[model samples]
Target: MGLRRLAATGVAVAMGGALVCGCGPLGADGASGSSASADAAARALIAEASLSFRYVGDSHVDETMNQQLEIKNATRGSVAPVLAFTALDKNHQEMPQVAVTTVYGSDRGGLVVPYGTSWDTLRFSGPGEHDVADVRVTVRSAAAARIPAGMHDVKTQALDSQGHEISRFERFSAVRLTNEDDFPVSVRIAYILWDQPPKGTTQQAVEVTSVGGLTEVPAHGTSVVQVSADAAAAVARNSNGPAVSIKAYNSQ
Candidate 1:
């Protein structure tokens, strides 16, 4: 299905008033200081919505071959872009398997890209690795993009508080997210797997890969989200200390 169709039914957005910021006096531009700041932030988000993709080769498991597409979101806004992948055989013809699979971001499926400089790895897999000679990925502009809110209010920690396994797959693989607000919220989390601890505000890791997930948290409540087993394992094998980043935002 096209991204538009999936986005229509996939995204569950709560539309409300304009962005809530400081409500002080209006500035020379005839806008409130808070509103001006909000406007600048929004403009940054829209400008940085440009997404770049890098084909990182392919990996195989049994009879399937999985192609990797690394996506980077440079903006501080949440973007849900449509990702389409195709596999072609040596004959330059579409593989016998499904030619196209649409990866659309949604609240339920955890496809939204949250704020800050972030990278996400998307895998496209199909049968018969030998039949697949080439893989191609295409990215579509996000139909809806907005600066995420209440990001700093969301706190996260590894579920493995003790020397025990928190996830069914691995220890400390699941994340516990706490919402301090009085109302319910939708949470988007990105697990940045860094080969080394970051230095200052700069990303100092030699190797980094990110996995993201989304879920709903009740008012003054917390939620436990399980990271992808394969992705977590990959991180465990590569990183000494991985960081769990969380954000909460309301869409209009």
Candidate 2:
């Protein structure tokens, strides 16, 4: 059976209105200004409707293949909505990546969630029409034991109640290794970002708690990688913060 396309859903009921503001910071003492800034940075990144993903698939699993779908806004007046990919492993663990694209379809494009937006589906826009930009399927296993040589079924749908096909790209397999077994193996994540600061800004660094550990890839295995829509915002805020720096957990 074909996998069901899950619709993206929304979070807020009202737009542009500041509801109840939380009380003073919690804990033994109020949060420091820097800590508040850091929290704000994290919250900003998290609030964006962007998506994120490991370039080479889940680090916790021993899979050798994965897939990714991305969309960007190409016009003004329209905000780029966040794109999300929820991977349901056979084991039932839910893996989610949230961030924006490194590359926007146009200069005016940046992640946007007009009030009353839903996260149940992928939405795209342009001056007049909408479309999907890229669809990538990765083979991240040892080259020797590459995915079975045959046509693998592939399909992509907007995670909206009203299924939409923004755009479709060619499907092909490429080889790469995740090195999930702790052995040394070379892996690379190639992606574009929207409104990425000049390289110099990225040079400014910060420290962040390790959210998860890297998985060791076996000598002959592969893993897939993809970026989340909200990742761009998170990366931008974290790296561009005044004092502390934030790094994408797996942005190597």
Candidate 3:
């Protein structure tokens, strides 16, 4: 998606009615000052908005390599910024970077919860190493490309060398997904392959990997795209099928 489309979806512009600041008009907050003050105040609130991430440890259980993160809106105003998480190597080198964002019906696009609200279950794939030391999370509000919507209707299949679904194959680590929208959507999916169960409720920490490639799904179109799955998780077998866990916005 382009920047304009993303912006158009995230922040809804009231195109039907032009809200012109008048020469003499009261404010919605009942203030008797300049009419533009309301709009200005709102803009100022988010002008300096920012995002912060809180690491909540990692989990490697239930065939899911869970890296829990808390997305915090530290600013006073509500904002919708795209969150990107980059895994780093021991030497602080950049590795797999996953971006958690989405574009929904008008009023939502990569829209994180409002101010003071935190969203969890933000995920991406890389080295699911519990012992890895470095990781970085960056937030950018201005961008052109956006992942359509949180992936939906994800399925899995075992394929042969010819890409034909078969009873089984050596590759038991794939997930398939299809876009369920009127426009194109981009998504990166993965399956947690090998993992080691940690003590107690802590999920098994494993080496993480995802289906490598960005998939584009056209409006109301269906195509099978394969992703990764853990072969040794005891739960996510090649034949176990594809599954997804996306934290998405649901309009009330």
Residue lDDT tens for model 1, 77-156? 56655455555554546655644332223212235554443333332245643344444544432433432433334666
lDDT of 3 by residue, 183-215 (tens): 555544433332324342223223234443555
Leading candidate by lDDT: 1
TM-score of each: 0.38, 0.17, 0.37
Clashing pairs in 1: none
List, residue by residue over 1-252, the lDDT tens digit for candidate 2: 111122121121111212112222433456866775555444433333232222221112321111122222122222223222233323333323321222211112222222222111122223211112221211111001111111111111111123322211111122122333223332222221112223211111112222122322334444432223443344334432223211111111
Q: Which candidate would rank higher by lDDT, 1 or 2?
A: 1
Report the C-alpha displacement of residue 161, candidate 2, in angstroms: 23
User: TM-score of model 3 relative to the true fold?
Assistant: 0.37
CA lDDT of each prediction against the hidden true structure: 0.42, 0.23, 0.37
Candidate 2, 110: how far from true, in Å? 16
Task: Give me the displacement of residue 70 in model 1, in angstroms.
Answer: 0.9
RMSD of each: 14.5, 22.6, 14.1
- lDDT value for candidate 2? 0.23
